[model samples]
Target: MQDITVISMIFTTILALACLFLILSPLFKWDTYIQVSSKGKDINATKEALLTTLNEIEFEFKMDKISHADYKHLKKQYETEVASIMKEEEELMITNIDRELKDEVEKEIEAQMKTYKNKKGEGK
Candidate 1:
């Protein structure tokens, strides 16, 4: 009977410790809960947020909930921000395309050089 109680107590203690560790593990690794965002993704998210704001502003203006002057100012500001984000996205796309093109061109050049060398060797 005493041996059974001791075994039960040890099992309960181990189970409690395991449960506590499982519950607190995420707290120790809080940084992993956050996702790392790239610059292009950030720009796209900002643009989407700005567009939503613009839509809300337009709705408020149409509903006569905002002054004409305020609507114009806000609309202009948000539009400018959206345009800037779009330009940045376009530039990022162009940069990536250029890098890919350069890599492809290099690979093609290497392949052609190899073919030419093989043909010359065969002739000899």
Candidate 2:
């Protein structure tokens, strides 16, 4: 009975550790991937929301629910909103790429500077 209890305890401890590791692994390993995926999802949702709003505005205009002048103004507003959102998304992508490229170039420059300094010191 004592041997059985010991074996069961050992198995329980191992199982608990395995479960903990499984739960924590994604938090550490895939955090950045998850964040990027979430950002993409948000952008998609914003696009969909803007499109839906534009459709509604168009439907109201066609049904004569709004005056021609009002429809024209509202349509222009929606178009502007869509354009701004698209521009923001494009800017975000460009900024992310620009930042990464800048970081890489800075790292390369630092490495070259270090090498130059090392050679100068060696000559002295």
Candidate 3:
């Protein structure tokens, strides 16, 4: 009876430690959560700012306070600015995706290398 209680206590402690390690591992090891959250916030802010600028430009054009040439020039400027922002956002997204893919590929290569080493060791 005492042996059974000791074994159960040891098993429970080991299981608890394993669970704690699993929970804390990601917190110490990676920035995936932070990076993704920051990117999402930045993209949302940029989109909102661009939309506000576009609405203001349209309102001014509708009010007819500016001449046709001025309106055209301003519209072109806004379009260019918005397009530049979009391009930058797209590039950032692509960069993030590429980085993740590269990491995955590297991990796969490392796993393959480990497998090869194990096989070679077994053959020896």
Candidate 4:
């Protein structure tokens, strides 16, 4: 029947479009949460996960689900991990700033040399 044919055509068109979209989505970077391997991002994610786990561990201890000895061990371990992560994050930021400053200074020096050369050539 004509109705059946029309329905099939419509469905085929939709399927084709869906396939095309899936194929192009990655090329266009339509994914909302692209995982980047930057040190800062990893540090923040690790810190957040550790903090969440610490909160859960504390709650469990309060609810009498964990022994005092075990709770203390876990809390101390996680606190130490968080502290290290924070220190690393700070160091990464300082390193990044220093690198950017170096780059900027190099660029300025290059620009000044170019300008000086141009002026010297024009005076000849």
TM values, all candidates = 0.71, 0.48, 0.59, 0.59
lDDT of 3 by residue, 1-124 (tens): 9999999999999999999999889778456766676876766687778778778877888898677888788878878887887888889889999999999999999999999999999998
Model 2, C-alpha of 64: deviation from truth (Å)? 7.7
Q: Candidate 1 on 8-121: residue-level lDDT in tens?
A: 999999999999999998779644444354556667778899999999999999999999999999999999999988888999899999999999999999999999999999
Please tell me which model should have the higher TM-score, number 1 or number 2: 1
lDDT of 4 by residue, 32-101 (tens): 3555546567779889999999999999999999999999999999999999999998898899999999
Candidate 1 error regions (>4 Å): 1-37
The clash number for model 2 is 0
Instruction: Give the best candidate by lDDT.
Output: 4
Rank order (by TM-score, best first):
1, 4, 3, 2
lDDT on C-alpha atoms for all candidate structures: 0.91, 0.88, 0.85, 0.92
Clashes of 4: 0
Q: Model 4 — which ten-residue stretch has the worst lDDT? A: 29-38
User: Where does model 4 exceed 4 Å of error?
Assistant: 1-40
Top of the candidates by TM-score: 1
Clashing pairs in 2: none
